[model samples]
Target: MRLICPNCGAQYEVPEDVIPQDGRDVQCSNCGDTWFQPSTQMMAEEAEARAATPPPATEAGSVDAAHTREDALQEPPQDAWPSAPEPEPAAAEEHWHEDPDAPAPGTPPAAPPEPEADPAPAKRRLDPEISRVLREEAMREEALRSGRDSLETQPELGLEDLPEDEAARRARQSEERVARMQGLDPAPQAHAAPLDRDRLDPQPGSRRGLLPNIEDVATNAPGETKPATPPPADAPAPPARKRGFSRGFLLVILLMALAILVYSNAAMIAESLPQADPYLSSYVAWVDQWRLWLDAQAQALAAE
Candidate 1:
């Protein structure tokens, strides 16, 4: 029914059922100490045991009916009649034994009554500074929790700045969206008519898109009202400059003249360089040998 904090000696009254048989953890309001409080079941059992134990008889008159009958049988009172009617057999049998409820003659009386429990003290109010600090701490914790939850659930912001081309693409997408909402195309596509088969060249394939359309090739469609664009009068005819020989052609001509000059004066040229004489003679001998070999092969083929 009551609990006391060991640290602060503060008392608390709690219902019997509030504590289970296994005990419960309780915090002291005064000292803020937490401890396991024993269950009240054991206390309740002790109270029941005390209630079952009968009180001791203090006065002779206070003796039980069985004790009075026994005393009456053993010693008759002087004023009482000698021939008092005897109790009924059943009553006599019932009063034959001493009262089991009464204590023995030399036994002590019941235990002294327990002293009244003291009233629980009133809780002291917290200091103003402490209260303010606790309040601020609670507010800070709540704010931190809320901020953390928001950070977890809130989506991160993607790149807000975009390149010019990306911005243009997004603009186009928005325009297309607006157009779709209004039941219109954002970019209308041109539908080209099929060209007539008769106008296409016979040599070209019969496929529809194989040859270029006559209107497209001519740069103007028939029946168009726009006048033909005449050539600009200020544009002069292209000049007809005479063709000139490239450096490579002139180099080839020079090489040919050198070859002619060297051939006409071959002996003099070989005499001027002794190394040239051996090379020239070897080349002529090789050409003559090739000619003889070709003639012999021709004659052998004829004989065959």
Candidate 2:
């Protein structure tokens, strides 16, 4: 079956059953992002899994599946993701700093100052009035759902469990009145369109990948999974080696040189700052002043 990687738009495939069976983790071959998405069938299976389980089990399973699936689907592509439309610089790209990976000069990597850590989780918003309404609505909907569902299952329910006829009639009237004011219930849910994201990645020696953006780091994997985080801007980097002369080294050298120059200058200044004898000061001053005076006197005498 052909699958399109969401990242690179590359196409690839795997045996149909292996998809959910191997676990729904799919990634693009062109890039190395891994994400999970329940195929329509997988979703149905999930729903069935939910219905068949006990209430507590169903809740837990739903939460786990939801979390896993959410984490799984956000795969990055196989090839270079066109740099995130490079955020419009707060300043220009020139000031943006550069890296070897930079498309051109400017937009370089900021010096190895640590890249900011992963962003914190997004905050949830809750408004008091709105939250109150939502809570009430949720409670009402939950009651409606529970009431509707319990009607089918609980055998112990009695006539007393139901509303009084007059109250029921009044409630129906109020509901109808409110329904008329609001819109009608939404139409039945429609089938969602099928989406398949899978692609090719190049193996170390081979020209092809099992998938584009993701590959099985487990060579057995159709390919690797997408990175949990996007690869650092400096990723796909060559192996690490001992630092020879990084900026730190240059900075150390500069500091040493500055220290030497400062020390030398300080020594000279220190020697001068102490008061000198008047004779020495005068003698030095006379060398310059006396020579000029004598030359002037000779010139005047000669003129006379």
Candidate 3:
């Protein structure tokens, strides 16, 4: 049987039994076009039906019938054959078609709506007293921080506030103090002139000069002066030491006095304080035992 592709007019030859009685789909090897091909039996039946039809009376009708026969023999029109049913649309596509707001096919999808920002968390109300305390604490901390920053920023010893000469003198004095603390002698100044020992000596009656006393200079180096220590103030006489019994000694004395009192007034104690009766009886038993032991020792000595 011969099969013709309607799309590209390409033809293929195959066995008659390859197609079913109804029809079978066949593809063109040259153009890759697929179409249904009727079986040889069905084609034969169709041809017989066409032949049985009455002949056309007019010449033009006969000519048209001949052309139709030629067309059927070459390639049948696609409309004459039953077409495959179309596939059903997807559920979502069907819904989209029903919705009026759906965008037309090939149109870009609308941008997704931005998420709404969450509402700001509500501030918790605080007690007036607590708020005031917190505010004051914050202010105090801020003041302390500012004070520390100022202290760090400002020059130590307030050198910026002093005259240049005074500042230099103070710096030198600080250096000297540090050197002394470290048990080091201060370095001599390059600019200072050497001191004249003879001129520096103080006269007997005149007021003391700018230079230190001769004895002090003799004891120490010329450039270095020992820091004068303040006189020791008379310490207040130490608080009078109160002579008193120590806690343990006083406790022992109190215990001895209590024992004597209990022993002398055992009967009165038992009558006055009923709670002391049991303790009094135990103490009396202990005393009696001790006396008996002493009597036994005396007897042993007499026997020896």
Query: What is the C-alpha local distance difference test score of each model?
Result: 0.70, 0.60, 0.73
Tell me the tens digit of each residue's lDDT in model 1 across 1-304.
8899999999988888899998889999888999988787766787999999877666545667779788889985576556778768997687687879999999999998999999999999999999999999999999999998888565744432433343334434554555454556556511122223344335433434333354553443334447778999999999986556676788899997986676566678788998899877765567569779999999999999
Instruction: Give the candidates in order of TM-score, highest first.
Output: 3, 1, 2
> Model 3: which ten-residue window has the lowest total lDDT?
190-199
Model 1 worst lDDT run, 10 consecutive residues: 189-198
Residue 105 in model 3: lDDT: 92
Q: Alpha-carbon error at 105 in model 2, in Å?
A: 69
lDDT of 2 at 50: 92
RMSD value for candidate 3: 31.0
> What's the true lDDT of residue 188 in model 2?
22
Alpha carbon deviation, residue 234, candidate 2 (Å)? 99
Best by TM-score: 3
TM-score of 1: 0.18
Give the alpha carbon lDDT tens digit for every residue of 149-216 in model 3. 88845445643454434334444555465545446667754124232234322454442443235554
| C-alpha positional error of residue 298 in candidate 2 after TM-score superposition, expressed in Å | 99
lDDT of 1 at 28: 93
Top of the candidates by lDDT: 3
Error of 1 at 158 (Å): 51
After superposing candidate 3, which stretches have Cα over 4 Å from the reference? 1-235, 238-247, 294-304
Query: Tens digits of per-residue lDDT for model 2 on 222-304?
Result: 33435577668966888889677697899999987975565445536547765634544454556568679999999999999
